[model samples]
Target: MSEKFRAYLIVSVGLACLFVTSGVGYYGFAVLNTPVGDEFEWSRGLIMWAFAFFFIVRGLVAPFIGRITDRFGSKKIIICGALTAAFGHFLLSQVQNIWHFVLLYGLVGVGMSGMAIIPVSSVISIWFDEDRGRALGIATTGVGLGGFVLSPVLAGFVIPGFGWRMAYIFLGLVVLALIPLVMIGIKEKPKNYSNDKEDDFKSPDFEKNDVRGVFSNLSFWMIVVAFFLTSMSNTGILQNHVDFLTTTGGFKLQVIGASLGGVGIASTFGKLGFGWLSDKIRAKYCTLLSFIFQAVSIIILLNASTLWMVWIYALLMGLGVGGWAPLSSVLISKNFGLTSYGGIYGIVSSALCIGTGIGPLIGGYMHDLTSSYYQAFLFLLVLYAIAIPAILITTLKN
Candidate 1:
């Protein structure tokens, strides 16, 4: 490898690692959502809430990992996370009761906490300077790409062929395999840039790396609140996407995989294209563009009665969501400075987890209550409308 592009190698391997996490951990729940319920003869809302609890626990545990990243860095944390996730998946494969689902997923959540967003984003910020946003966009694209590759591969092939039980075991092995690959690839920047004034966000008060003090900043709270709602609304739709499509379109499993995969495919472009723009323009503006796109995607989804329409909604929605994921790191770096990137990002990530937990739980119950997703999607649109002003008014110009 060349001397200058070592960071790129780190980013590449991290992307693949993220792809595995996303495929099995994040999107995997969606693929398994309905089938698990059917096998257990439980209400969809009950199991979906278990998935929601997983994220809540993950969000709560993430800050602790952030503190570890701040003190010791990410290598050990990530390796442990991968190992725990493998074990969690193995345990999940053996679950025979509702508490098994919730408890084992909580264990999965703890593993997720170890492989937290704070550690990964902290490394990216340390490694790349001028191209931070774009590099991050590329790195985080694993989430989408994993969905593209793993979702269909799981839903279309694995789940149907081997049953959900074996699918869990298969995912456990994938995580176990990714452990050494992550350790081999990830590294802190050779030089510490934390003290550099030039690298700092324009916020003068943020030079201290004070976790408690961050909550006092209006801009920081803006990020927390906005992402919280964003996570809640988006994950609701995402966790339920396969079931929604299967019901509405009566499509085959492979076709359903393709539709979900479309989100992943479109998200790759979204991250690459918009992340490039965030470098050229303002990161927050790129964020606004994403919010607009996500809002439009949901509005379109409300009327999606056909398979093609679902694909269109997935494309637009994925793009919008994609922008937010990478931009959070860039925008946080812009607004808060990198003195304590991991902790601040951890808190934001935690808020994101909370929202992620809320979305699917609410969606599941709403589906149970009204036999429709209309209420949940409508709830998100309104939240989007509210967020535009929130983002617009929060000036990064400190």
Candidate 2:
């Protein structure tokens, strides 16, 4: 095969990998949140903790996963991740209690970290240099696409017809199916590509051996702070979205499922749109624009009493959050270069994971306390406001 064909193939594999990992592992969790809670008669906080634990585990392991990708290449790790995540889903089908659920979900988290942005981005960054943003945008669009399809499938068909336990098994099967795709398509970068090349992209500073200096880098921390806050805000709303609509908005399960699926579709467009736009404009400006979409969506959500208003919120929020994954990789590569891309991004992802873990818990806690999600969402908006400056001020001063 030509190098160009090989490059595009890698992107296809990356997209398929995320579609399963985030689809079954991430978005799948949100759809299951309510049924699992309702079945066990657990508090919203406890239910949210399981998700929190899942992301926290992913965060804890992200740095290691990144380093492993740096050392061993991403192909092996991606294979292992597929198996581990599928096993986690299968185990989830047999959970008899909350502890069993949380621990098993954390195991899934470990698997998902392997398949997530770090390794995928590491591989993609090596393939296309100038158009990396567009490549990443297309690859990561799988995340939203998976959610768009899977949310309704779980909500309307799988969970309702087979039950949540069967739903877990179904998700497992979906993940297991990706093994062939990974085995056939995933590959290391070209032999001509050297990760150690700092000038591969135009940045103000590139360090060949400055892995240690990454810790002291101002731009790195700003990215960390921005993503952490953004994830917390985004995840808080997402994890609680179903319950909020069910209890507060008085919507039926089918309607809620449809709305979530619509969000997924909007996010797909967001990833593609913002991803391409990032290459044309400054990634910073594109990111800022995406953030604005999310922030405004939240405002619409706060006042949403009609179904149309909620749908509007879904569209805007999808577009906003969709840009996050690709832009994150773009920003890191733009500023830090790909030499330590895995490790640097791993740490940043760790912070984002922590924020995601906290988000659901905060939303759950606020709901349990107030018997409403209003306060939790308001608090999330404040975090969004704080994150804006962190991203805005981040500059490659090195």
Candidate 3:
């Protein structure tokens, strides 16, 4: 293979593995929630905190990983992330207590931070320019595709057969197998490459100010705040959707599992479509449109009483929510440039993780308090509305 093609293959494989690892690690909690709750006689709220712990650790670790990627490159970081993820999954297989769950999930969070979009996208962004948007779209599509393929299988088989523990062990071994590929295939461009040459890629521009500088940019703040609200809306709905369907909509577990899988399929298309569109249009406009779709989907979801209604809602929301993932890096790259892309994007991504971490916790807690998802769904509607104006304001700026 040509060196360039080899590089793309390596990065693509790394991204695929990262996406699969993240999909299983993050959504594994959702599939296992009811099973774990039933086993321990724990409340749904308590079981859901495992996801919260994952997001919190992801939020804290993202910026540091970004910085390390900027300074040291991605090979070492990705290898470490893969290994941590493998170890974390092994730990998850052995968990018997709440603290064990928390610690293992936290390790998964750290692993995700090291392996997630920021680190991988930073490397991909550096390697291509002519097809950067398309490349990124292709890379992130792995997340939606992985989820589509795995979530239902997990819900139907893993949880029912050897239990969630064995599922973790199986997933851990799979992630471990990818580490050597990442270590060998990924590389930064030659340092001597001329930025002005047509064939050479230009690095992102960074202001001399450090991480604190990102806080001063209004556009950065808007992206952070908007992403936070969106994350809350997305996670709140997804993490508890099965429970919501069972308790409120009177759906069977098979129906709920199938619907979740269907949503994952829709999300795969959404990620690709929005990513391709972002390349054609401005990323800000793409993001705004995605938020609008999410708002409408949430409103529709609020009134869903039948399985079909919920499925349609899930499809629409998946398109909107899944699209947001690729557009995030596009918008950040447009505004900040690549020089500080990793660190700055990492900070913004942290806010996203925080929102994701809290959304399900708050939603589960609300359900525990009210015995219905109505209040949480309404809260999500309000958040989506709030995000619209923030996106408009940020996009309008130079």
Sorted on lDDT, best first, the list reads: 2, 1, 3
RMSD of 2: 1.7
Q: Please provide TM-scores, in order, for all candidate models, with all chains considered together.
A: 0.95, 0.96, 0.93
Q: Tell me, what's the RMSD of every candidate?
A: 1.9, 1.7, 2.8
| Candidate 3 clashes between residue pairs 3 or more apart in a chain or in different chains | 204-338, 204-339
**Per-residue alpha-carbon lDDT of model 2 for 1-398, expressed as tens digits?**
88899999999999998888778877898889778889889898988778999999999999999988988888898889879998999999999899999999899999999988889999998898878889999999999988877877898799989999999999988887888887888778786876555555534544444356577667778888988998999889987887888888888877777788888899989999988988888887788888888889889888888899999999999999999988988888877777777888899899989999999899999998999999999999888788888888877522
The order by descending TM-score is 2, 1, 3
lDDT of prediction 1: 0.81
Residue 82 in candidate 2 has what lDDT?
Answer: 79
lDDT for each candidate structure:
0.81, 0.86, 0.78
| lDDT, residue 208, candidate 1 | 49
* Tens digits of per-residue lDDT for model 3, 1-398: 57579657855865676566656776667777667678778887888788899998899888899899888887778788888988998988888888788778899889878877887888877776656677777777777777776776777687678887888887888778877777777776544543244212212332333566666567678888999899988888888887887888788987887877777778778878887887788777888989988888878777888777888888888888777667888777655667767898898788889899999998899999999988987887799777888888773221
Off-target runs (Cα >4 Å) in candidate 2 are: 195-197, 200-210
Candidate 3 matches the true fold with a TM-score of 0.93
lDDT tens per residue, model 1, 1-398: 55357788878877877788788888888788668889889897898878888999989987788878877877888888888888999999989999989989989888877774677777777777788888888988988888888877787799999999999999999888877777778777655444475344555444445577687778778878888888888888888766776775576766767777788888888988887888888877888888888888888777877778888898998898888768888877766766677788888889999899989898889889999877876886788877777777676752
